[model samples]
Target chain A: MSAATPPSAVGPPAPGDAGVLVIDCVLVTEILTGFVREEVGKVGFRRGVVGLSGGVDSALTLAIACRALGAENVVPIVMPYRTSSPASERDARRVAAQLGADPLVIDISAQVDAYFERLPDADRARRGNKMARERMSILYDVSSARHALVIGTSNKTELLLGYSTIHGDSAYALNPIGDLYKTQVYALAGHLGLPEEVLAKAPSADLWEGQSDEEELGFSYALVDRLLFHMVDERRGRDELLRLGFDGGFVDQVARRVRDSQFKRRPPLIAKLSQRTIDRDFRYPRDWGR
Target chain B: MLSDPDVLAELAGEARPDPVVALAQGAPRLGDVPANVDRHLELIAQAAERGADLVVFPELSLTGYFLKDLVADSAVRLEGKEISALARASRAVDCVVGCILEGDDHRLHNAAVYLSRGEVVHVHRKVYLPTYGLFDEARYLAAGDRFRAFTMPLPSARAHREWRAGILICEDLWHPTSPAVLARDGVDVVICPSASPGRGVGSGAELGTAQSYDVMTRTYAQLLTTYVVYCNRVGYEDGVGFWGGSRVVGPDGEIRGEPASREEAMPLHRLERGALRRARIANPMLRDERHDVVDAEMRRLRRRSRM
Candidate 1:
């Protein structure tokens, strides 16, 4: 399709169809790999460290980083809790092997359990949040040890819905696939020819036993990706979305999630008092000359 | 100048060869004027060695785009050493380079200067300051107020006739009036230096931004009947990638040559005056343009708007 053709003229993708979200993966791969290399190299780092969850997002990120900084320069760290799915680890290892990267496995069971033992009544959500932060801590520590920048794996679908923990899985030195949606991530993974096991598995954070992202969110990625592509990227109004045959309640819920999660997408707000406050009046790009 | 019957009669019998021009697609270091000057000098030398009569660099070739607060520190005066170096390098080959110019009134402007034979011939400040959507040029720099064309002397030994040229920095070319004014002024060529960011990655092989530019440049070349030279930058600046597919389009609206996207390159193409003459003779759009009608209508519109 030509870039000039608007989504409305082409007709919005159906609720369960994400064909419009399919991108030219070859062009996207070239752009993203160049982004990783230049952004990381400017900061004086030649290597990248990524936390692998055996999920499609992280696997694609590792593959792009390997292509950007070479396979030997990218380190895939797999951190799993005691109750985490064993198949996740196996798939992550398989992905690493296919990409010619050695996997470094670190179990967070002891540290997480020791902390939760104090609050024995804590629920699964609390434990999951702690585990995410703990994994982030280990990745940063490994980044310092190996002198590599920490690369993030959060996709646009999760980021807009605030599904991932802020400053935990969301924090990184640079992200190769942050702009891509979950559906597009799968497309790019297929283009890059990732491991078949990783591609075939169900999407999950592996935070707790029997945890599935779609099941917990009460909606499939295909449905929400189509909705967000219109509501967010195309700037469609609520009434316009309803006219296009989207569920009213589902639309409101997704809109609220995006509105409430605006804080997660930005730096901490600073009150304006001085003449030139940081990120306010005194603005500079992050890649300013050193 | 071509409108003068005496000049037209004098040029009817003389033979002039096409002038070879080079488009230098470079990635300047952010806020580093001295380093970028060195890079431009090297490219100018290379273009001269390759038998190019002129070389044009991308917008803000002396300092990278997205300067924001760095604009104050990176702004250079016309008398500064950086421009002086470029002026000296132009002695070997005429060059058009971009920089943040600090005017005598202490205001900075996004400016592109045409240098020839150790002297600055013309300085064109970008009149359109795009402030919306990923651009904040108006916040840090002052806007220019006019579009004017100047005579450009060709470096070809066989061609003694000077070509009337105009420089439109990136956003300036987007407004149709900017190029229309230059076309009315009898410009034979329009040179644009751009720092266009790649965006809208859909199902197409080319970037959406690139497609828009291709359509716009081709339309302008065909309508105005002038050679269009577009030189865009490449590489990343704060995660914004500048897609460099620099090319030269003839007066017939055909792309002569273009470089690969997202890479630094220098592609050369000769601008044939014979093609320009043939296109203008066949179309006669410029000769038949009614400027008096446009001027009267603009004044009437202004009066109505005020009322």
Candidate 2:
């Protein structure tokens, strides 16, 4: 490399001398679906299944999979809990209708209640996690029974914050929206021209009645994302942030959420006393040993 | 990939075209940051005034990198009221420093503000994050997944001279996908803002730090057939010493200009635009791309047991 002068010396071209490099995200996504299609063919599999909850993320996932693998290749599972809203069920069926995928309406309320009856000492978080795990178990079982891989529905935002239930919603053979933010998801949904009902509804896990994502987090995705942007993207300091015109209370809150969620972002910690740990000591890609 | 000989012959044959580059280097830290960002900006502005077309800064140029707690406080909403000062500055000097952009996505990103023709043209976020080592990027950032490209005024203010440029945050340049994507999309030059750590690398060590990085740069510049202006940060931050050895490697595996290692000096390089067109004509890697090779996900799935 030349060492005499840095490249920052060059001046920008005058007005009208620059060419724009716009990314057609929609087209890229279509290309992604094409890749998924080719992947399914390469695997010699014609069928796939999706656990659709009528949420925008899942609906979009199911829709994309349907386009890539076809309606016959995709399955939509709506496993409603006791508190699952009717709107959620309707949304799931609506998405299935739009995508032409058959809907499997399996109300797991009774089964979840049975488990709770056996173990009355379970806490809310535990119960919620159990519900999530139960959904995954059903999806995987159907996957095995149908000889198909379960397509993951979690988006990038959930992945970053560890907002997903591990071994439950997070376990998947493949994921499409793993790189997009919640905000970007909305944009993509618009590009896909999805049903307005799914796009307009407030985001929710539908684990419990009226449980919204923003309410539980005690902050909006907008504010949390901004705070995260400052901390994560810009690599700014906490004190300098206050000088930049953000509320101290909000900054501290977002920082705490990001800090507390670190455990979720990593592989489960194994005591280093043992020689071999999963990600750290025994490092390999997912396909290793196979 | 085209051989170096093939690239050099083509570049040598092309008419000597004036070089224009848009730079993106390390920016100032928010609070308690070393006084290099402002000083560097001043140096870059002066260099630009001396007929340099574009002067780029690193991600978060006005602030330090990885200010985890300081983002909310130091974040600048590019479209909001905070960018007024930057807009004014860009208009005054006709240069854009890659600014720490507080995006309306409600996310703070290590973004580059392309100030050209007296306006902020576009902003690019750092796509790849270095989560390992002393970096805890995943803790604070939402990774950028899109490969949106931007066109800026060629660093030469010459009328009728247009150039396509792309901005990649530090870690993004390390990955082949970034340059590949940009080059395939038809960018003339790729600017990288690197905050690489400086250290005493043992001579002849297994990982031989000195020779390794320049090799990486040469390989990429030649492979992509695009001008590469790598502006690395100098000095240290939080025990990490930045080795400032910024350089511009031509598309044909030769150095046009190299800055002193870890020096707080702003040296300028003159690049010939004709060199790029000539290099591309000789070895058109962009025209010969097979996107099938870019998939890490599908490969992982296939390698796993089908059972």
Candidate 3:
């Protein structure tokens, strides 16, 4: 009430919006930036490591961490396989150059081949998961050597559709763009002045040659986001979408994917017949240390 | 047709005068003893002297809202020395200002204590404490369960005119039950003492808007066909801020008086409750209740539950 008193909404970085993806990037960045500053203040950390996938999500995340933790505090890892595209390697370099950080290239083709040889006749999915975990193992070891936290790059779409390899690319100490959808990742990457090549490319895990997310997932990220907006945000039913001029088959397909992938969206479910479980069985977040 | 200057002069006399209520955005008090209350009390009385019958102050007028842990000590009981001072001060121009009421139960409550004709008529505590983001009111204050309205005898020695008034505190206005109960009791006017926080969530519900608060107040007013007076506190407290924006609406939900937010200013408005009786009589929102649709289902549920 006095002249000396300050007003609210002071120094707020960005206001939120109704579209979750548009505002989620800011929210995630704010949380991660805050986390890094607070964690760094509490203890000493040598640097931050990011798995640079030459994709918009990782590029945006890497850029954010580079800004928050400084170029010297950040180390970008580019782990390409022998079958991996040259463009992917070049895109990773472009991201590193724009981010003003050096990239550490670790070709995992020989390692992956040796891994399959040791256990022959392994399924492609199993081998892919192993590859993802192998990359995370390398990142963790390098993080320990550098005394840094592993910054994650998987965006909301990858997390939502279960497109990410568990403990592989999904493994990180903190994620700055995990809440943003894949489409929003490009938007934010543009906002942060990231390289055009990284933002415009078709997103790929690049575990093997000639693999694209659309081909594997049976739908584009744009269509997934649109269907998600209708079902999740608008809370519309399948019949309602059909009545609104949507193809019934496509609506049903997206709805099924949304329902099926919900498990990956949440923490691994634990049977809760006991007193305590891995889930929010107890009010630990609220009553912790109280 | 009554002007404010004419009303104040008549009320300024020692003898009993016509009835009036002054509404204002009582700014925040960052300390235990409110500095703003003392600073604005003189000016408020001057405004009251002009024609204000009863002065309505915002929620936590003496001490600011979001006082957090300070509510324990900052909240004074109606019988305390601080309220006694306010009661005595109300006698100067024969006007009442809102104050927090701490009861004997030892639970602090957000309340509005009214002083009229050198006496306390009624003290109404808030019935709701919004526990959503940035609000932990249930942690400090207890919710009041009673619904109350009082008749203030007029000053004229021979006149039979008496104003029946009802009171609600803060979040009480948000719920339909609070105002519905009061209006059902045939209250001439409903006075809401509120301390709404500033806009933070960026949802459809925009705080500090005339329409946002007005929708709730006027909806009840139109339903009951009674005058609604809303008084809100202004200024920042900790991280949550208050946007004053006090207003008075008629039975038809028309704005009679609108006060600016973020300032300590008084705007006196007049209402004749008798004029709304016909409006209520013609299209009664109260009388058309489908008891069979509501009560029957509730009774069925109760019988099935064996409660």
Candidate 4:
């Protein structure tokens, strides 16, 4: 009511600074399944295929795929490198058995090793990226063979940080679990009735011996999920993030990576010399055929 | 079987004691006419079987909300198959459906169709087309120029007479003019079918949309002394998610009934005409509104600007 106070001083509505979004798991499951069904159906694909990695993300993705396009319509492909843990293969089989999902196992060691023989000086990161691409190639080949759409397994945390190899684990026809953070992934995995063995284990890509994703990223998924929830979803600013007690270094690094990985999430840019460039003006939805 | 006892009090003496309006909160496929029409028919039959005399669907109920150029593809004539299907279904229960309407002059309006007993009774084209935030209604569809209440003729002998009902799309009710106009005209019920998305978490309610809408609709009901029925869509389209918390707010601004959160539901509530009468008598907001003074002031402002 004071004349000195300006009316235009008000800002936009404050973002929801609520703690980690405790999801309605049932609704989320229904939505994910519906998304899968709707997305696949729109493209006229009757079946879904996922590269099962024996991790929580792929497991959740597989469960959703089964519910969406019946168990019979989903093809779980377990493509493992020669150095992959035996427990991973066993766990994949267990999940396949649990869901009545008939899985197709392909040993990708021969194919990857044959290619790497030409380049012997490849490091851990290089080998890891190569392995990811090799697995993705096998998934695509299986998809073609079985006439199924490849379901992506990367979560929002890995996605924001560009943790996965592009056109490798990231290449897919559609994804059911990409929106979920790693912590939420664990929660949903628990809700979906995955064994404690899987949930209790340190999260890894099975890239190298004892290669945990948390170790590589240098932060626990729980902390990162919490931080990302505030910084991105809630749109809290840098000052607020630090005020909320997040480490400045981690927040800065995550912000940089999310900015850097923008290209990974979008279509490749086309030089616009014509009146109708593909992404410029002649844009159509991915499911435009429907 | 939970019901509002205040509305039940009207059973003894009021002209229409219980007006059953079904809030059909469904996430319609984007730009799919025939399929959405079929889905509407299914919901109508379900609601009618549950004894709802009226069912209101979300804005752009036949076509999803975020259509840009696809609005052209989704546009349907009032004489088309979708309307025919809706009309046939209205034989069971009155239906309010949102769609892109192609007019005689080839103009299109984002409109709400009121179907009653196998006939298209009224079409209230959206008056205010929002162009902010996630909305681009002004850019895509032609904005309609008028706002008016239609009539609802119930079957009972005493309730057979036409009841004045105003229709507003998503953003129209946000403005004061539409509701004020309808309130002055003594509209008994205001049906708002919205595709409002879920946003914010701890801004007092589950969603920022829900909190703001709750305040808006409840305040409007109190001001207008009319039954406010809000039917919102659920499910994600492209990326945006609509939170479905469809409900009926009494003229007292108290929520009578609501469906479960973020799910497909057809929530039914009985609107009490006696309660509206009492609220109107109690508040008299509409009766006290000085439209003449407002009109004179507008003219004077215009004259001053011109001079």
Candidate 5:
């Protein structure tokens, strides 16, 4: 390799240019598949239970899990709320059939509605949170019953922006695509030959009838993924972000979201009283023995 | 198996041919030293069956890389039973094994032990403890202070050639001065054992970590005019996966065999003395190295920094 001019000498890419966000799909696929296989196998589980929402993130995650732990070894569970789009369920089933893995459909409307009957005035956010947690509880229950680990499907954009419920869809035994951005998730999904409907549809939480992620966030995933890549991954500061042609308000807004949602990314903090605290100074790897 | 007496007689009789080195790229169970020792013994025996004269394992092969607080729990003293077991296994073939070494001063270190002829031939603790970005080695372990080269006996048909060998554990090779010191010490081969995690998967078939290692090892081999044997581990430890791309780079900076990635593999390659001699003769970079100038400049810079 020849010594080239430093990147600092060459200015950063203009905003909306997401060329740096593009990944080598083949190599990323190998790494994620190997990660799933080793992490799941190390914990002594031969099967994985994924909460497939028919969104690109979950669909891509399930596909990778099936590739890692064979389609026969994966149990893709689709738990749809009553307000969720019917297209989601159809797309999820299509993906499962395409991967040759039989998926179990569990309608969560009964439990969600039964609990909400007492509080008729509950808002959309409350209902969405309840539905997400309800799905999480069901997935864990099935994970126990089937003796499989629950694979997470939250993408990096959702995780960094704290766009996910804390103990809801954010919880899993292992996540293969949490580090990937939303754009990268769709890229990998395209490379894996997922259902065209799943890949082409707008991303959504589907908690209510017309819930769209981009509409709620008020910006495109393509734009934010590029902005976040420069801000977080490359460690560019506020001035440097503006120098890179990012809007001042947009950069501050995304930075604030990342900071505010930091609590959602970590475990509940424990107050220290002893000489060695659990997460402080008394740290051990999660995979200590196995 | 050859008896001790038979092996001695063979060694005394005639020099053997080129030495075959095996890279035992196996995943170690976390905090399980005894089980890892058993696995090391099995790999050693298998390499012996394949007629390998030397077998090199990845960094911390006896204990998983992300030991964290388990460093104390899995650390092995030099006179401990784990090293003794590995020493006994070395009676069959020479082996380089990595572990958490509990020093006589009670300070633990990330170390590699070279065992030969049922004895602990040399131990090189990792000099640089990388403590940033997914590495917390300095927080848990002590760093080694020096780099030294030792005699490694390789059998040749012409005569008994005592090859000078040095062991630079993982991050030590990242620093130019470490390998330069060994090159100045007249080391013929640098055995690097690594537990490198795979990252930066953008626009390449290889992980960024693997690509960086390839560049560094090949550059070191060509510049120093010495063989570079790299053995990196595979498997996951707490979600971080170590990429296994163990390889041998000749003095001419050419890769000899195919490297396995993200999986357990044992690749053995022959180290040709003729190739080493030819590269050194053609390059002659090591012959005219100005060490005195470097020493003078370093002293001057140290004084200037203090001022």
Candidate 6:
């Protein structure tokens, strides 16, 4: 190769638990940024918006979005609940500030508390669902106000685990980081020059006071990344995973979650009452250019 | 596992020559010969910096695709300025470019010229002009009557090796013999420069034009036991969207690297010539092909089916 490999202008390799699926981050980022620009431009859209959750996934998406649509065009709205960590908000603010993005900070505490006040019998699960929906509601309102399409921040590992709220956090017009695994998100976050604090912090949904993602999922992102990379992408069967030093119980659990939550990854299935079913025959893209 | 340099040298000599080839997947404006030629030179230098031994562009890339009456203005003679600049750029890397070449008979042919070693080496004009559907090539440009492989210099880090290769314009490789004839001539590499547009709604089974091309190019590689360097342009020119799915497939009939998208890109791929030798030795399909019998039968059928 000429020029002594060009000084790795593509960036260094991000560490991963699974040796498989080590992406070419430079090429991937370029192609993905180009994709976002092309798809958005095809529909005559010059602006975009994303819900900034202070998590690595959203941080990575925002970075790519900023590159694609420019910081001025990308509106990162941070909607924090009362119980949401101060560090998370600080990180989100830092991300917006670093990108020169004027973020809209809308606290959803009053909205969530008001809804919970009426449903006094609502448990933590019910409250969490409501909070997720409330945040989305604010995001949509902001999107309308700014004439921007909402970008999603759900990761592939989380989607597989059904860790996100349906019709709330899962709803989006377009998503860039959804294809990456949770661990891959961290790697890309590092490459994109996200704050060290954001990368170092334990990932959480921030629905409660101290709810870490690993605790809820009963496995680490590194472990799940390795398992899912082999299971989903590599198409490794149960025996193969076991042969590759994976516990049988862990494999069974991950496999069951991925299989059961397949519905969350797709649109609502409509019955084929007509020739062009809503989710079938009449299905199309976002109509960027017909 | 002895560390013998002589054994390593012998093995390396037999290994595949994985030379880098860059695909210039940018759209050229209609009849913009000078600018397009300049762009080609820039891409050639960039490809050379990226270690590319050869760089290819789309069909009639000097002009735009879907040329109606603009080909006359776009056509250039062999000694034209555009060819001369490209020939100078060839000092950095080999160049295969599609153009409307002005023929000796004073006609314009949809042509692909092979430029290497600061000279215009060979020109393979388009053998087939698609007149149906969206294409109207037969109405304006002269069709190439010949199809043959030429010996071109294959640049390597150590030394230059002579390689038998062929070039097929957009619609030429659709026919079976376009690739078979080259394989019969023992060509190792065949470059296909296309301006195919993206079409159809992506379904569960396919991705429209990309999927259709995948089957065709991969089948050609496997059948001929040869490497197929397929470079298709991206970006819309006059409402027609070109799906940039440029790829370099080895004799194993698989994509060697990530393909380009619907963007103006110059994706570099290192194609291994060793894969051809490996595939041929493994299948022996080319060795076992009875070209004489097939040729004789085709002639007999042609002679008998006369009106």
Off by over 4 Å in 1: A1-19, B1-16, B156-158
lDDT agreement with native, every candidate: 0.89, 0.66, 0.68, 0.80, 0.89, 0.79
Clash pairs of candidate 6?
A: B16-B274
At residue B128, candidate 3 shows an lDDT of: 85
TM-score of candidate 2 against the unseen true structure: 0.47
* Predicted candidate 2 versus true structure: per-residue lDDT over B143-164, tens digit per residue: 7766556776553555234567
- Kindly report the interface RMSD of candidate 2, rounded to 1 decimal: 20.7
> Candidate 5 or 6, higher TM-score?
5
User: What is the per-residue lDDT of model 4 for residues A213-242, given as tens digits with 9 covering 90 to 100?
Assistant: 887888788777878888888788987776
**Which docking band does candidate 6 fall into?**
incorrect
Candidate 5: residue A138 lDDT (0-100): 94
Leading candidate by DockQ? 5
Tens-place lDDT digits, model 5, residues A2-112: 123222322444644547888999988888898899899988999999998888998999999999999999999999988899999999999999999999999999999
lDDT of 3 by residue, B1-307 (tens): 2444433444564333335567766654553455645754675567556766667787777776766556666677777776666666666543435555677878888777776555676788777877876577887778888988877543421222466778888777778878877876768788888888754222233332445686887787787888888888764443234667788877777777555545567777665544454566776776786656766997999999996
Q: Candidate 3, which segments miss by more than 4 Å at Cα?
A: A1-47, A143-147, A278-280, A286-290, B1-307
| Residue A213 lDDT in candidate 4 | 85
Against the true structure, what is each candidate's TM-score? 0.94, 0.47, 0.52, 0.81, 0.94, 0.58
Off by over 4 Å in 6: A1-18, A287-290, B1-182, B185-229, B235-307
**Each predicted model: what fraction of the native A–B Cα contacts (within 8 Å) does it retain?**
0.81, 0.00, 0.00, 0.00, 0.91, 0.00
Per-prediction DockQ: 0.70, 0.01, 0.03, 0.13, 0.79, 0.02
| Tens-digit lDDT track of model 2 for A1-290 | 12222222122321332211112454435544754554454455777788999889998788788888888889789999978899999988998998888988888888789889989998877888889999999999898888877888887667767788878899877777765567656766777877899999999988888889988876666545544555665587976555444567777766776677777656676777677666655533232111
Cα lDDT of model 4 by residue, B1-307, tens digit: 1154444445444445356888999878877778888899899999889988788999989987777777878898889988988998898888899999999987878999999888899899998999977677887688888888878754421253356898988899889778878877778888898888765533233566778888988998887788888888987766456888888888888888554477788888877666776887898877788989988998999999999
Report the lDDT tens digits of candidate 1 across residue range A168-189.
Answer: 8988988889889999999999
How well does candidate 1 score on lDDT at residue B281?
87
Better of 2 and 6 by lDDT: 6
